[model samples]
Target: MSKEIKEKELIIIGGGPAGLTAAIYATRAKLNMLLLEDQILGGQVRNSYTIENYPGFKKVSGSELADLMQQQAEELGAEIDEFDMVERVDFSGDVKIVETNNYIYKTDTVIISTGATPRKLPIPNEEKFSGKGIHYCAVCDGAMYDGKIIGVVGGGNSALEEALFLTKFASKVYMIRRYDYFKGEKATIEEVMNHPKIEVLFNKDLVNVEGNNFMEKAIIKDSIDGTEEEMPMDAVFGFIGTEPKTDHFKGQIDLTDGKYIKTDESMRTNVKGVFAAGDVREKEFRQITTAVADGTIAALQAEKVIVERKKNQK
Candidate 1:
């Protein structure tokens, strides 16, 4: 005899702003929902020390915001499962199966809100000095380099953005780029170039990071020629790019560029009854506010699907 299959109105993967917001909306719509998070509920926002740009709150700690969102979601009757890593997703059948390390969750509708991860620099000692002197998120560890010289690797918008933000504490900021031309927007590039505290290095690649316990210096090679040089610094920041976390749903859904999921305006993926939101979806902006908006839209769409499916059966 076959085991009885459990089913839910909606299942959301991830517990960040996107996922929590979805739960809030879906629960309010009277949809039975289950939210699963690999670690804590907060995603990248939990790593941030301070968040000043989020609306309503002029200034707030990342942890505080996450706590408030989680509380609100729970109050709305959404079930949250933390520290559950999803191993696979089966969306081919009418009832989706989400397998985690501990249990299997079945749902008629699914929403994926997994966010992105920091990109690393491809250089020697880069991995070795990760905690020592190398860093990726300036917002998380910028305070430690107060009044000290720091090097930022990359030539994109995020790289320049972090360098500009780091200038508040760092004595001097070195912006290193492998190409002479930066790919960031004109405004960001111009602002960083004109900043007196920022020194832009063109056609330079990080060869290695040298230091013990703490970062002391960085080895850079001229991309055009074979000339190499060493630059003294207290810390190194890498912002080359970001990679979306969508590995578990490899063949279950359609992906854009094999990274982000392709979704319509309503956050509906190619597969019916399955949706995606946050940085995992293909979109122009990846901000917290935009991610929350994605969550709201996805949850509403999933709720509609659930209601219609039940109505059709009756």
Candidate 2:
């Protein structure tokens, strides 16, 4: 005998803030919703040590905030399943089908909130030293390297911001940029440039990383003359950027030039009954507030679409 395919009114493809917020709305709206999370429910935010900008809470750890959201959604009757990797999704038919490693679900509407992941360099020893010495998420690892010298790669706003943040713990921070100029906002660039603990290295490329059991050095090549130099570093952080988690949905939905899901202001995708929110959507700003707003809009719109479809059937 085969396992029964579960049917739901709405299926959320992630369990981050956006997906959790959607669950809160969907369940309150009396929609039978199911949220699928491949890993921990907090997504990338789980790694963040402290978040100060989110309203209501002055400051809170990412894990704590996520737990609260998950608890609220569950109390409101949202069905959340974790560690279920979605292997395939089919939105071509009237009823969207999501196939996971364990089960298949037929859902009336699908909301994609699968967020992005950090993009790392393709250096020769980059992978080898990932956890051993190289690191990402300064919040998670900064405290471990107190008073140690660190190297930060990239010249964007995120890189600069993280470099500054690391200064609170690390004794020295080397800001490595491939171009001669910084690309971040003027204010941020100025602040980082004027910071006493940050040493800016322009026109440099991270060619290789080396360490015995842990990272101790990084090899950099000058972009202008290609002269190579080794920098003594305790740990290296990559704040380059992030890549959207839409590889599984490729060719199934329209995407923007950046490969993020193309959604309208209402969070509706080109395909009917399909919606996207959070960092996965192609939008100007991607923050916790924006992600929450996107989730609210997508859930309300999904409810409206379901009602309209029912009326048409009648």
**Maximum-lDDT candidate:** 2
The TM-score measured for candidate 2 stands at 0.90
Query: Which TM-score value belongs to model 1?
Result: 0.85
Model 2: ten consecutive residues of lowest lDDT: 44-53
Model 1, 230: alpha-carbon shift in Å? Answer: 0.9
TM-score to native of every candidate shown: 0.85, 0.90
8-120 in candidate 1: lDDT tens per residue? 88999999899999999998998888899988887877765566678999888778998999999998789988887888889999889988777777899999998888877
What are the runs in model 1 whose C-alpha is more than 4 Å off? 1-6, 49-53, 57-61, 143-147, 164-169, 179-197, 212-214, 223-226
Per-residue error (Å), model 2, residue 312: 2.8
Question: Per-residue alpha-carbon lDDT of model 2 for 1-314, expressed as tens digits?
Answer: 46469988899999989999999999999998899999999777777666767899998888899899999999999999999899999999989999998888998899999999988876888888887768878878888889999999998867877888899998999998999998777977998999999999999988888889888898999999999999899888997878899988888999977899998899999899999999999988877889899999999999998888789889
Tally clashes: model 1: 0
Clashing pairs in 2: none
